[model samples]
Target: MSAAISAERQHDLDTGAAASTHLAECLAVDFATLLQTAARLPVAAVQRMRDAASKGITQRMALAATLLREAGQGDVTHWQSHPSDTVRGWACYLIGSDAALDLPAKLQAMRPLADDPHFGVREWAWLALRADLVAAPLQALPLLLPWTEEASPYLRRFACEALRPRGVWATHITVFKQQPEHALPLLDALANDPERYVQDSVSNWLNDASKTQPTWVLDLCARWQREHSSAANAYIRTRAQRSLR
Candidate 1:
């Protein structure tokens, strides 16, 4: 199934016209039964649908995710461990948006996906859970803080990525927009992370917050440097302060 989308993407570089058309055709025939039984579409086509960013693709993926949510938690959980990481990732994506589930329950299911071997799956893990965090930043703080100390750098990065004030490919978090200080605990935890990936996320998180609170950012970075500066911390501070004019 992924092979077909890859072929379609190759055939159409500038747009996903071929991919969208092929996906629609495949959904109509080859995957109809599987979609009905599992209540989730193949991640291959879904990922393409999202990456393609076409209105047609958007509508298709939204409908599929909606169906998966309606199918019930047991069905979603079954698909969450599908052999294909793509399938599992889409499962995580669907469950992350389960409005019926409380935020704690939704995030609990998504935590494992944050450490998924596949990068895209991990990305969706954060993306799928971001809205709930944005809606209640204070609530998200305690839930997300533990990940900052987790052994996996990916999970540590997820802590920052999930709570960024101005995340990419998602809506801006209005709470952080007004009071970036709310993120200090998570930022402090990752100030000197050994992993470059984690450090980058921490820095980017601060950079995002800094956009609307230059003085606060400047003060925080200065205090961090004064209190405990290391090579990694220096790098993060430098990266975060780069755009503060």
Candidate 2:
């Protein structure tokens, strides 16, 4: 975003309304603009833009995909190890979004991040799980599953959370089903996740799993009843029922 545009966006956010009517009524932009906006803003501002970008991409899967193409040119050497975990992590995910980028190189960039010591970076790890590296669950299963055992609860939680069935880099259910067991350990680690976000994400995973492996979810209900309680079981059970329907 240019300084003028950033100033305008800042004003719109402050006023809580789109300022388009006065500025030629531009409704949306390409992904690059969306990311550029996200990169330029503070965290609070970026959250809204990130959500907007996620929705926009969902609605326009093929349209701004070119933005993903341009993301590969970023110099990750400076970004990959940036002190601000948020910068390095998000940059990695953006790089992952570009399907044509080198997966091996991307993996090399992420390898250090996989074991990142900062909880803040660990939290965003899931956000950075781009599909380009693991179109199939089996391929990403080993890479993703091990994080569940990390001592940091944040990393453990995100180990499963990254494979979220929708939005950002991962929007495919086919990959989740290919290796149901791949999610098993992560689920176990997250069953008692302290964070509500992580807990809700666990439900989302089951909701997704219900589509591919009802037996596994059913077994989960049976085994976890003593621990997860009737309510959590009900949530998982409802997800199962919906899957069957």
Candidate 3:
């Protein structure tokens, strides 16, 4: 591990803190230690996660969720409310990996995590179900449309962020890349959103599409500018076309 990771591990060891306050601490968190100390997971369970670390975060998280299920700790509500963000992230994967839950059920279960106060938990929320969304974009898009009008900017951001054509740290949505217009309802709803957080997500969503559908992006931006000339829309348009320019 790097010195930075060592320091973070040592800090958690010394402080016995259950939750991370920022993204770096979230990334550097030692799951084995946290599961043992904060979550009171059994030594065997903790060791499983420790061994899983070598596979990296995504796989580790998936394994953690599986372990939870096998141990009869599959109640996502309990994990979701855990003091540790990593544990809450485990809840996301639990929901994601569950083959029993359909798309609507999964989205309903994911709503709270999608708007989780911790940034890391919020990211895992969308990332957890991203594959399912990609598998069924037609069903997912309409289901997520209402999220754009949600009261919290985080929920609004999740509506777009979760469906980005080429999101970071996740698989691309080929349907959006080839047929970006399918997602226009979502894009249009948030076009004039006041929050910079939501605006950034919208811009990045468009930017992702622009890579494969530049003309579509340009036309959409031009239409938005013509219909609603707002600062938020302008910012989104500018950033969305950054790659094309």
Q: Whose TM-score is greatest here?
A: 3
**How many collisions per candidate?**
0, 0, 0
Residue 231, model 1: lDDT of 94
Q: Which pairs, if any, clash in model 1?
A: none
Q: What is the C-alpha lDDT profile of model 1 across 1-245, one tens digit per residue?
A: 35445554433422212212333332322223334334444565445445544344224434456556554443566766654444454576677666678888887778778887666567667777777877887998898899888999889888899889998777799878779897788889888999999989988988887888888889999999998758999999999988885
> What lDDT does the true structure give each of the candidates?
0.70, 0.52, 0.87
lDDT of 3 at 61: 77
Whose TM-score is higher: candidate 1's or candidate 2's? 1
What residue runs in model 3 are displaced by over 4 Å at the alpha carbon? 1-16
How far residue 11's Cα lies from its native spot in candidate 3, in Å, is 4.3
Candidate 2 segments exceeding 4 Å error: 1-55, 58-73, 77-90, 97-128, 151-154, 165-169, 227-245
Candidate 3, run of 10 with poorest lDDT: 8-17
Estimated TM-score per prediction?
0.75, 0.53, 0.92
Off by over 4 Å in 1: 1-53, 56-61, 70-74, 83-85
Q: Give the number of colliding residue pairs in candidate 2.
A: 0
Q: Taking the tens digit of each residue's C-alpha lDDT, what string does model 3 give over 21-126?
A: 7666776767677666655667889888887877867778788788788878888988898777888899999999999999999999999999999888899998
**Residue 237 error for model 2, in Å?**
7.5
